[model samples]
Target: MTAMPEWMSPPRAEGWYAEDLDHLPEAPRHTELIDGALVFMTSPQRWWHGEVVTALTIALRQQAPEGWLVGREMTIRLDKRNRPEPDLLVTTTAYDPDRTWFAPEDVQLVVEVVSPESAHRDTTVKLRKYADAGIPHYWCIEDQAGAPVVHVYELDVPTGAYAPAGIFREVMKRPVPFEIELDLSTLTP
Candidate 1:
């Protein structure tokens, strides 16, 4: 009998570390590996979240410095056993075009447009993970309110917590260097 390569091994029902993801024959829709566990996402309840994401992307493009990438729906490898697809990500242009996904090291900012089902996970689980991985920025957009609200978190290296940047008013863009000048109302549903 021949031994199979690690990637070819059968996947465990839960607790999916990064190594296990390498063997996934193909990308499974709406699944992210968190702390070695497979977390599935429900489809968006409405298109408002997506529209906000698009607005943010466009705003970033207009204001971000050269050599920075404002990307949407990119899979970032946060650790050996975890990957989460954020709605938006900003990073320096050093990304590897040949690689199938961006590793944690390649990430600079991660943004999540919260769905009704995703609010808890986004604020707690995902927030902690991003902080642990030392990701510089994390943004959570909540549209449940009549007007969309965005929560910005910046990593504090020594303490490792994602502290809020501030309460942004009508227009909330990504901070300078990343280009954050947009009318917040446009992003609201």
Candidate 2:
């Protein structure tokens, strides 16, 4: 057996657990656990990013039914090792307001707003995680010329993956999960 080089060493402890995230000051804030691996986030990446996330979170919260919650940039524990902090997510069940993370089963929808540093992860990495966890809805919002463009997906039960539902630019009206009508222009502006 050969020893691994220092440059090739893992970022954190091997087979990281969700509870370990609680101890990292930057975690569940600027870090995430993906399949037992630690992934750092780009904080304050863009001013528009936070604004859009706030808009979507508010929209989802208003439409959420009783016992449901809309979380922003909070961790969702998909398993013992996979705790991903999505930009926005809707939980099917209400939280105690002090919980650190959510179970995958309670997450109905997950949203990600792409940034230059996280474009690949937001589109491919997190997309696969949410699909594997069987989240009913996923929305990928991209900023184009200071406007928000949304790409919607619905889980395909037979394949345990997501299928394209629709793409919205100026406005979005959806009935699944809950009734929501969001003005997309307001998100970036």
| Candidate that scores best on TM-score | 2
Can you write out model 1's per-residue Cα lDDT over 38-101, one digit (the tens) per residue?
6666564467877888888887777778788888876678877778778888888575665556
Q: How would you encode candidate 2's per-residue C-alpha lDDT over 21-76 as one tens digit per residue?
A: 77666433557888888787656579999899987888777777888888888888
Worst 10 residues of 2 by lDDT: 4-13
lDDT of 1 at 4: 51
TM-scores, all models, native as reference: 0.82, 0.87
Number of the top lDDT candidate: 2
Give the runs in model 2 whose Cα sits over 4 Å from its true position. Answer: 1-13, 26-28
Overall local distance difference test of candidate 1: 0.74
Q: Relative to the true structure, how large is the alpha-carbon lDDT of every model?
A: 0.74, 0.83
TM-score of model 1 relative to the true fold?
0.82
Model 1 stretches astray by more than 4 angstroms = 1-14, 22-27, 173-179
How many pairs of residues collide in each model? 9, 0
